[model samples]
Target chain A: MDKMNGAQLTIKLLERFGVDIIAGIPGGSNLPLYDALSHSTTIRHVLARHEQGAGFIAQGMARSSGRPAVCFATSGPGATNVMTALADAKLDSIPIICITGQVPQSLIGTDAFQEIDTYGMSIPITKHNFLVRSARELLEVIPAAFRIAGEGRPGPVLIDIPKDVQLEMIEFADWPAMPQRECVKHYRKQDILQAAAMINAAERPILYLGGGIRHGNAHDAAIRLAEKNNLPTTMTLLGLGSMPTNHPLALGMLGMHAARYTNLILEECDLLLVAGARFDDRATGKIAEFCPGAKVIHIDIDPGEINKLRTAHLQLVGDAGSVLAELLPQVESKNRQDWLNRMAFLKKENPFIMPGADDPCMPYGLIRQIAALADHETLIATDVGKHQMWVAQAYPFCRPRQLLTSGGLGTMGFGLPAAIGASLAHPQKTVVCFSGDGSILMNIQELATAVEQRANVKIFVLDNTSLGLVRQQQNLFFGKQYFASEYQHHVDFVTIARGFGMQAFALGASDDPVATLTKAMQTQGPCLVHVPIGRNEEVYPMVPPGAANKEMIGGENHASA
Target chain B: MQALKESYPCPPSDASGQKVLELTVNNHPGVMSHICGLFSRRAFNMEGILCMPIGDGKLSRIWIQIAGNSHLDQIVKQLEKLEDVRSAVLHPAEHEVFAKLEEYFQGS
Candidate 1:
C-alpha cells in the first residue's frame, strides 16, 4: 500500500468500492493496471479476447449489481473497439467505469504511436470523461468517476489515464466531491401543477417509462403514483423492470418490439406522461408521426432531456421521484373507461405468442414458468439475441431493476457480468442471466471472474446454435440466404460452464427444462442453463431498425414481410 | 429599418426555419438529439456550423448549419445574446461530405 503507483492507488480505491474483478485488455498504456493487479490480492483482472467483450462484461456487471462496474483497455484501437458497448451503456443508463491508458500527457496532442483523442471520442457516449493530466488527479477523478457513474441518471463514465501518469509516483490526498451547481433550471411549481392537472383530467393517460426510473431509484414513488392514479403503463426495452410486468396496468413494452395492445393504446391515447424516458428514434418510430394526438408531459432529473424530442406540452425538469412525490398530492384519481376497455380488448388479441415446435424444449415456456417460480424480487439480466427477446416477452418481472438488458447499444455479452453485478449488489435476491450461445461466446471468459469474485449468477444460455438475431434478420431481410449466421459446430457449452467451476444444467438433462431452471433459480452461485431451442427461432414484432412501428415484421404471422 | 433594407430577401415562412439553439449540455448528454431536433423541425438545408468549449466545465459551444444569408445573420446575433452562450459565430461547412445531408434537408 505504501508508495503505490497511480494504477495501484486507483485499483485499491475500486476495491473499496467493492470491485473484486475487472474485465480489460492490457496494452502499452494499461500495462500498469495489469502490472499493479498482479501484486494486489484484492483485485483480479480478467483478460477478454476483444476490448468490446471486456467493455460489455463491465457494462453487464454494473447493470446487474446496481453499482458502477470497472473495465479497462489500452489506447486507440482498444478504446475504439469498446465504443459500441460504451455507447450502449450511455443509452441504457448503466453505471460502467471505463478506464483506458493513453500514450502519455506530454505526447497527448502529438501524433504519437497508438495515441488518439480518447476523451473526446468518448464524450458523446459517457456520463463524464476525464483526461487525467496529472498523476495526482487520479485520487479525485477515480472516486468522482464512481459517483458520476452511479448517481442520479446513472451512465458510463470514462477515465483516460496516460501511461506515464500510471507509472509516475504520486502523493495521495483525500478525494474531492464534485460541486453541485444550483441547477439554474429546476421544475417550476406551475409546470408540475400543470402536468398533474393534465394527468388527472385526461381520459386516456398512459405512462411510458424508461430506464431512468431504475437509474434514478424512483421505483417506489413511481409505483405509488401509478397505482394511486390507476394509470396503465408501458415501458421501453431499457425500462422493462420499472414496474411489475404482471401488474394489471403493465403493458409490457411500447416500441418496435412491444406488445400489440401497448402500441395500439399508445397510438390512440390523448395524454402521455413520459417519465425518465427519452423519445429515442428506436422508441418513437417516426418523430412527427409518434403520438400525434396526445399531449406529452416530460419529467426528468436532467433538464437537457426536457423538450428535446417528440415535444412535450408540459415539461417538468427535476428529480423524477421528487417531482412525482409533489405532483401525486395534487392529482385527482379518475378512470378512462373507453381506454381501459380498448386496452382490454387489444390485450386479449395480442396475448403473449410462444414458439411452436415438436421438440419438448421450449425457451418461451421455460422463461415464463421460471419467472413465475422465481422469487418476485429476483434480478434477470439478459444478453442480446432471439432468446433474450423471448425472455423479455415471457418473463414476469415484479420489481424495478429486476429485468436488466442492454437497450441502446444492444451489446451481446452483457448478461453474465451484469448478473454478477446485480448479485453482488443484492446478495439476498436471486439473479438469473438469459443469454444466447452466440452472445455468451462473446464474453464467456467472465465466468472465471464470477467464480473468483464469489459473485453468484445463474446464466441461462438459449443454445439455438446460431447467431439468432442476425439469422432472423437474414431470414427476414436478406432473402433467407442463411450465410454465416449458423454455428455449424456446437462447442460443448456445458463443458465450458463446468470449466469455470459453475453448476451447469442441460435442457436435455431430464424430460423437463422448467424443472432444471426452477432448481437453478432456487440454488445459489453462478449457474448455467443450456436451453436447447430451435435454430430458426426468430424475434417477433421486430421494428426493422429505421422502419416505423406500424411496419412491424414477424410474430403476428410468420409469412415474412 | 436600415437593417431590414440591408438584409437579404426571404419569404416569411423561410424565416421561421432559420433559428438558433443555445443549449447548456450536461457534461454527459449526447448532441444527437439536438442535431436531430434541428433537422426534423427545420426540415431545410443547412449551411455550416462550429462547436467549441466556452468554459472550463461541460459547457460546449455547438454552432449549427443555418440557411439564407439574412436569416443566418439574424440567428447568429440572437443566439450570441442567449444567457448560457459565452460566444457565437456562424461557421459554414466548407467542403464536407455531410454537406449533402444538409442540402437534402434545406428545401426552404
Candidate 2:
C-alpha cells in the first residue's frame, strides 16, 4: 500500500500527467500545497508576481503547445485575481487547469481569513469545477479536471481544495487509472454528403475558419478543403494562423478591422461554409445584415453554437478535423473561374494599405520589420489594443499556433507573461510579444519572472503613451471626448527592464533603429525593446460597432479598376 | 406597456406555449447552480425549477418549466453540455410532475 497527504498526491498526479512547469504564487492557504510541490523533482514551479500573470502564463503555454496547462493560486484575493485569466480562457476556449487553495473545511461559513467562495465564483466561467471535501477526492478530481479541460470544445477547469483537505492523509493499494483520450465523434455520412453537395452547387462560396481550427488541429484539412473547392477563405482574429496569410485564396481576417477586399468579398459570397467558428459579433458585425444573401453551413463540435446566432441551413456536429477530412473526398473539385476573377478584381481595387509601411517607426512597418527579423517558427503573442490589431493585420502567420492573442476577452496585460510561458514551453524557440504602452503596464511586474527564468522572449513595447484603440474609438464614436485613455506621463520601460536584471533597448534614441531592434531580438534571454509610436496611429478598414461589414470606413489607398 | 406589447407579441396563454424540461443530473452541491447559471447568463427564462435526489442518491432528476420560445432548443443543447447534466429531455407543459404541484401555490 502507498500513503501520502492530499498535497503530495496532487503533485504526484501532476507529474504523472507530464506537467513539468507550473506558474503560480504561494500564500497562507496554499503553503501546504507548495510544500509538497517543493519535493517534486520532475515538476518546476515558477513564482509569478500576480495570480493573473500566472493564469496567463499557463494560457500562453496551452495556446502555443495546444495542450492543457496548469496554474495555481491561493484563496480569496488570489482566486479573485486569477478570475480575468479564467474568463479570458473561457471565451477563447483554451484548455487550462487552475488549482486554488481554500480555507479549511471547518471554517466553511465562519468568515475565515483568506477564504472565498471560489467554486461559486468560478461556476460561470469554468468548463467544470470541483470543491474537494476530503483528501480522497483528489484522486478523482485531479484526473477529472485534466480530462474536462482537454475534452471536446476545450475550456478552463478549476479545482478549489481547502487547506484541511490538502493536509488530509489517504492510503491506497494503487493509483487511479489514467484517463484515455476520447475518440473523435464522427458525423453522419448523409450530413457530410449534403454539405459537399451544397459546396459543389454554390457559385461564390467562402470558407470561414475560427479558433476551433487550431484547437482541433484541422489546419491542413481546412486548407485542403478550401483549395480543393477553390474557395476564398477568411479567418476570425483567433483563427489568424490557421492559414498562411499570403495564400492565394486567403482573404485574411474578416469583419471589423478586416481588409476592405475581404469584407467586400464576403458581401458578395453566395454561400458561407463556416467551420469550427462560432459566429461572434466581432467577426459577424451586425448579425442580421452579415452575409445577408449567403446561405450559411456551420460545422461546429458544439451543437449550441451551430444555430446560436446566425441560423445555418446545414449543421455538421463533429470534430473540425474529422468533419473536414470526411467531407473533402466527397466535395467536387471546382475552379470557379468567374468567382476567382471577381475576388482578384476586388483585391486589386480595395487592397489593404498601410500608410507608413516602409518606415520602422510606424506600427505596420515595425510589425513587418519584426516579422522579417524573426523566423517562421517564432511564436507571436500580442497584448490588446492597436498593436494587437496591427499585428493581426500585418503579421505573416503561416501556421496553426503561430499567433496567440486574447481574442474573445480582448484583455490587456496578456502579451508579456504569455510570451514567457510560450518560451518556457519551447525553450529553444523564440517568442515575441507585441504590446502597447497602456497594456504593458497592466502586468509589468512579470519582468522579474521572465528574468528569473531566463525565458527566451523578446518584448516590443509599442509606446504611444495612451490606450490607442480607446482613444481612436473616442475620436471616431464619442465625439473626440478622450477621457482616462491617454497617460499624462510616459513610463521608462528600458530602465524598468534593467531594474529586473534583463537587457533593454530604446528605438527612438538609437542611432540606427533597425540595428537596435536587431540587437534586442538577438539577445540570448528575455529583453524589452521600447518603440515609440504616434498617438494618432489607428487600425483602418474598420466596420463601425453597429454597422454592416460592407460599410467599411478606411483603407482606400488603391484606385478602383 | 401597450406599445411594448405591440412591438413584442407575447406567447399564447395556452399550455402549448410552455415546455417542461426533464434533466437527469449528478446529485451534487452546485449542480443546480451550474444549470441555472447557464440559463441566467444566456438570458433564457426559467419560470420554475424543482429538483430532488433519486435512486441511490448519487443522481438527481430536475424538472424546469420554461416558455416555449425560440431559445428552447438552445437551452436544451446547453444543458446537455454541462458536465453534471447526464440527459435533458423536453416534454409538453402537461408533464404531470409540475402540473400536480400547481395546487401548492393557491393563495398561500
Question: Would you list the C-alpha lDDT of every candidate in the order shown?
Answer: 0.72, 0.90
The CAPRI-style docking tier of model 1 reads: incorrect
- Score candidate 2 by TM-score against the native: 0.97
Measured by TM-score, how close is model 1 to the native structure?
Answer: 0.79
Q: Score the docking of each candidate (DockQ).
A: 0.06, 0.31
Which digits, one per residue and each the tens of the lDDT, describe model 1 over residues A1-561? 256678887777787767887888899888987888788787767666678767876775677556678889899999998888888888787889899999978888898999988877876677667788777778777877776676656788888899888888876545445433232235668887888889988888888888777766677777778888878888887778778887888888877677666776777788999888988887888777777689999887654466656667887766677777888888876666677788898777765456643233677666766667777777788888777777777777777767778777777787776676666556777777888889898778778867765666788788888898888888888999889999889988988888988888887777766567677776667778787878766777787777666667756733321
lDDT of 2 by residue, A264-352 (tens): 89989899999889988888899999988899998887767878889899988878999999989999889999999999998888889
Error of 1 at A288 (Å): 3.5
Return the top candidate by DockQ: 2
Residue B14's lDDT in candidate 2: 53
